[model samples]
Target: MTPEIVEISFKGNKRVPYFNPKEIKVKPGDWVIVEAEKGIDLGQVNKVGRLVALFEIKGDPKNIIRRAVDEDLAKLKENRKEEALAFTVAREKIKKHNLNMKLVDVEYQFDRN
Candidate 1:
C-alpha cells in the first residue's frame, strides 16, 4: 500500500512526519516542500511508510506541498551559503563580546525568514 505518511529530514537531522494529502508521490532522498508554522519549508524525504506508529505527532500531520524543483534546489543552495555566513558572523560576534558559549550552526528558513 502507498504510505499515507512519510518522514522528512531537515538540517540538523530534525525529522518530522507529513502526509501526502494531495497524493503527491514522493520517495526517499527526494527534496520536498511542506506546510510549516510560519510558511512553507523544505526537507528531504528520509523514510516512506506508515509513520503514525513511530511518531507521536503533537498535532495534525502537515501536508506535503510538493516536490522540490530545480529552482527550489538552487534557492536551497543559496540558503546554505547564507546560513554559513550567518554562522561565522555570529561566532565572531560571540568572541568579540568574550561570551562563553559555543556558536554552532545557523539555519535560515527556506523563505529566508
Candidate 2:
C-alpha cells in the first residue's frame, strides 16, 4: 500500500518530520508512526486525503518518514510493556541507591525514525 508523506508538528513549536505515503498506508483508524522531537511517536490516523497544497517547510522535508507497520506496532507494544517494567525497576533502583530526584512521570515515544 502507498502511504502519504505528511508533516507533523508538535507543541506548536517543533515539527517532528515528514512522513512518506508508504509510511502511512493504513486506513484512518490504523495506528501510525508520527515523527516526534524525542523519537518516533505512535498515534492513530485521524484523517487522510489527497494532497492539495504544498508550503515551505521549516526543517528539511526529507527528514519526515512514514507510519508504523505490524512489526513496528508489535515492537512498540513490547517496548511499552518493557518501559513499564523499567519504570518499576528504576524506582526500586532509585530507592536502593538513595537518589534524590523524585519520579514524577514516565514518557515513551516510539517509531521516532
Candidate 3:
C-alpha cells in the first residue's frame, strides 16, 4: 500500500510535506513532531491524504516523528508569547523613531541568540 501524504505548517508561513507511515493518526489542526534539519520541530497538520503529485515540492516526503507532547505544546505557546512581546517592543521603538515603514511579521529563531 502507498503511504499517505501530509502537509504541515511551520514557522514563517512555511509548509512542508511528510509521509504518514500510518502508525499515528493525525488530522488537520493536530500538532505533531516532525524531523527538522537540525532537530525535531513542532508542526501543525494542515492537510493529509493520498496525493498522486504535488506542485513545486522537491525530494521525497519525510515521516512524522510523533505526535507533539504536552511539553512541546507548552514550548510552542511560550515561543508565541515571546514573539508577541518582541513585536510589541519593536513596534513601540518604530513609533518612537517615527519610521514610516510598516512592520510585517516577526519570527523567533530556535538558536536563542
Off by over 4 Å in 1: 1-3, 51-55
lDDT of 1 by residue, 64-113 (tens): 99999999989999999998899989999999999999987898878876
lDDT of 3: 0.79
lDDT of 2 by residue, 4-111 (tens): 545343322333335464443555555555555666576654434453124444654433355557988787777678777878988999999999988764446664
What is candidate 1's CA lDDT for residue 23? 79
Off by over 4 Å in 2: 1-28, 46-64, 111-113
TM-score pick, better of 1 and 2: 1
Residue range with the least summed lDDT across 10 consecutive positions in model 3: 48-57
Return the clash pairs for model 1, or none: none
> lDDT tens digits, residues 26-72, model 3?
88999998776666678899887754245555897777888988988
lDDT of 1: 0.86
What would the TM-scores of all predictions be? Answer: 0.88, 0.51, 0.67
The alpha-carbon deviation from the true structure for residue 101 of candidate 1, after best TM-score superposition, in angstroms, is: 1.7
lDDT of 1 at 107: 89
What shift in Å separates residue 33 of candidate 3 from its native position after superposition? Answer: 0.6
Evaluate residue 56 in candidate 2 and report its C-alpha lDDT on the 0 to 100 scale: 48
